[model samples]
Target: QIVRAGAPYYLPAKIAEHVSMVGELLQFPRLVPKKVISVGSPVKWANSCDARGCANLVTPSVIAQRYKLPDESLPAAHQAHTSNSMAVAEFQGQFWKKSDLDGFGTSCHRDVSVAKTIGDEEPHGGIESELDIEYIKAVAPEIPLTVIYNGQFSLLKWANQISSMADP
Candidate 1:
């Protein structure tokens, strides 16, 4: 409560000095409540916890087929996304297991290039980055993919790096 009251006076100044954007202020994050449930059990979408019903299961092939591929060549058959700055105490970036990717049916990917992970302790931290890669790879198998983890804790740095990229 004190922070919320004081944020109006101090946050703007601090943000102006060091941050390019302000998000999730004065509000709790929207996340699903983690709970143990039997496999294949009924589930509710989003942040709901009540066992309302089973979640819709869509096969990767079906998802891939649902959308048509672009007629134009896919940027030399390459797909990529940049990982933004993670919070302090958060996991550093780390590559997902190749076996998991294969299990997800992305076996067609010849190789994945991860940039800007030379000094990262974990290289790639969460499944989010891995999932991002897997989703694209699953949808468009055989496409070369790149996972660029922005280890910096500042969006401005990531922005600058992206701006400096010749082909993004």
Candidate 2:
């Protein structure tokens, strides 16, 4: 049995997609639907035995109860209501708003081109320079403009480097 009860951040859409793809590729005649059990309250161990690890099974509810989390704001404490899970085919949608950039300041929008080429320059101009501000202003008069950096890979590389330092 699969248990998917937690905050939306921990659940991703790719898991269900991958499972579907694998089943299709393998040509499974009948796919078995798995049971997804969501426990409303987090489980806590009564004894001090550490088989699976002390924190593994300890639910957010138990933490909230012990630490006294507010009842009205206990959605974060209630593990089952947080996560979206699929037993066989479907998956959960993105939890965060689709922003132009993530916390790392990487642009999510793709480059929009005008013509194939403009004034002997590439349509979007050189990478470092901003798009022709006056031309864009004339075309899109009302919109406030800002430059966004497409630096996802660089951010990831920096994150990896920082994470590696924690290794023994």
Candidate 3:
């Protein structure tokens, strides 16, 4: 039996009255980091499972050749970015690493920082940012991408900005 003053089992009137849950260990939630998989250029089909599986990886060059786009188009994957910005950029956007657009197979990413520091939370560790960055970069390799992070989005300010842009 637990004889501690604060343990659930410990229920002495005087001790319980004085200490609700003092001297107890704090149990923080477990943060099981996700296993990073499928990074960099794609791999060709593996001849056998024995060897690291190859194949199935498709890069910009592969996509270009397959679709037969003009050579001038380096990535020639996704549509060009307009003045407003791509749908992905409307929100937090993507930022796994600051590096330029790089994806599997015939693509490149510039080395840089893409995320911001919020409170004690480290930047560039979000699954949303990672996924968005990877896929968007894969399709729009040529487009310049930026990430603007903030503790508060200021919905009122955003609304005002949008309203101001509307036919004044």
Candidate 4:
């Protein structure tokens, strides 16, 4: 039942994907979630929990980060600072207006490339794989960039993925 909730109790590298895949393969979504009338035996619904709002769930640090100031301050440093930036207006007028985003791209655009090159091939560049960094640069041009490379034995693979997608 805990596996059904996609909860990894100890490690982040749990294979919950396979479990979910098997559940889907067996048409479990259509079969499960029938609320019962009487239950003397031990039973638990995976997603049974109190509903939470942003006020209850968010932290002070998260609030600060979410409402952080833009790179360049605008006319007034209010909540609408980014929206009121002159640069944004100019960018919108010159670049955004001219470009046809009718079929520009989807909200989530990603390109993943793997390299088998040895780690010590180029020590001058940071730990991040050069091929991967270059791929991201070419794909998402003219934006703030941060690259994070992880060792093969690192525990938090999710953090590595998050760092790669940090800019976007």
The TM-score values for the models, in the order shown, are 0.42, 0.16, 0.32, 0.21
Expressed as tens digits, the lDDT of each residue in 1-168 for candidate 3 is 333335545567877886534332344456689988967885563121121332354433345456665553445544455652332322343234433223322233222223222222234445676555555544444455454343345544444444454331
Candidate 2 vs 4: which has more lDDT: 2
- When 2 and 4 are scored with TM-score, the better candidate is 4
* Total clashes in model 2, counting residue pairs 3 or more apart in sequence or in different chains: 0
Highest TM-score, which number? 1
Higher-scoring candidate on TM-score, 2 or 3: 3
What RMSD does each model have against the real structure? 10.0, 23.2, 14.7, 19.6
lDDT of 1: 0.45
Model 1 vs. true fold: TM: 0.42
Candidate 1 structure quality by residue, lDDT tens digits, 1-168: 333434463456756887545543564446688996766866433221122231344333335445754422457434433342221121245445555555444333223323333224452236775656555555554444545555555555555655566765
> What digit string (tens of lDDT, one per residue) describes model 2 on residues 5-90?
35543225767654322211122245589887975776543322222443544332343345565442345423433233211110
Evaluate model 4: give its lDDT: 0.30
Runs of candidate 2 with Cα error greater than 4 angstroms are 1-14, 17-128, 151-168
Candidate 4 structure quality by residue, lDDT tens digits, 1-168: 222545534324466543322212122244567798885865322221122432333322233335572322233422342222111101111212101221112111222222222122222433223333433422332332343333343334434444445332
**Residue 147 lDDT (model 2):** 32
C-alpha lDDT of residue 5 in model 1 = 39
lDDT of 1 at 39: 69
